[model samples]
Target: MVMDEKGMVMNANSDNLPKDCPQISETVNLIVHAGQKYATKFNGKMFAFDQQQWNVKPCAKINITFINDDQIRHQFMIHGLPGYLYPDGMVHLELYGEGELKASLIVPSQKKTYLVHCELAQHAEKGMKAQLKVGGGDGDLPNISAISSPIKMDAYSIDWTMLKWGGMVILVVVTLIFVSGRWLLFRHFSRRK
Candidate 1:
């Protein structure tokens, strides 16, 4: 882990290889940015990673340059790694504000998708979520902004009873206005006569 006044890179592995993998298959360099502007592409999202998904070969070494475009705390964390190599099975990079940090991690040979997100309260739920897929991934994780459906979707149902009542009320109001206007016109003409 490397720390400075700007940001910190925690549990990044550049050299170490997993037990199932004899050597690194490839090196993937990813430039990921985090901020509100990135979230603008996604409606109702407050924060997000630049990309929603990534795919790499098995045992591929990933070098990530995480850029925080906003002047606030943000993180790029990958979960579901081997705990022996990565303590807590996570590679985390955090920026205190608008800055960038470079880090690396190696994925295992198993075909799986790792969850990448910010640990801040409601950040992932708000949209700072992504997927790192090794070998096309086992499957898609739920609620990966624009990628898959949310685990729990929002329900919006219309009440027919309320609709009927509202329609009747509007019809009555319009009829009363038209009748009153017509009656006033007739009364004016009669008075003039």
Candidate 2:
């Protein structure tokens, strides 16, 4: 038996824990390294190098350390959780620049799967997405390579170019109609005079 910081007796005896429960030795340390690139692309789509996956156990006190290698900014965010587990119903860690960030979160003793990803636009859909499982609930998260991700085309891509062309065509047609209507109105007035 050992006394915790709160002066509570913590018995390490096997009988005190569930039969299949793994021994809770200490707080678990989960390290995540962030950079500006990914290993490979998916289906010719560029993968965003913002988010990554991590596997953890339920009821475990997790200490997450984020190491940013990029020159810009990045974030590590986990979503889809009960409000009681977190102050704002999310686990958010932001790395403003190239440095390290540390945060802790307690996983509830429940069996569930959650989404871990970056909140940047199209980042999650590109490749900045991951999954977290607690209590071994699901079989496993799909392998990063096996997961099919949507392509994140830039705003000036072929699709947007077509859209812009369509808008230009509509604008020209509307302008022509307005100009023809004004000319017809002027002709009618002059004929009346």
- The prediction achieving the highest lDDT against the true structure is 1
Candidate 2: count of backbone clashes, pairs at least 3 residues apart or interchain: 0
Question: Each candidate: how many clashes?
Answer: 0, 0
- TM for every model, in the order presented, reads 0.80, 0.55
Q: What is the number of residue pairs that collide in model 1?
A: 0
Model 2 stretches with alpha carbons more than 4 Å out: 1-26, 39-52, 139-193
Across 11-118, the per-residue lDDT of candidate 2 in tens digits comes to 111122222346543467878766646625444434344344455676666677767676655666766555644545577766656777666666666676777765
Question: After superposition on all CA atoms, how large is the RMSD of candidate 2?
Answer: 10.2
Report every candidate's CA lDDT: 0.94, 0.59
**Residue 39's lDDT in candidate 1:** 89
Per-residue lDDT for 70-149 in model 1, tens only? 99999999999999999999999999999989999889999999999999999998999999999999999999889998
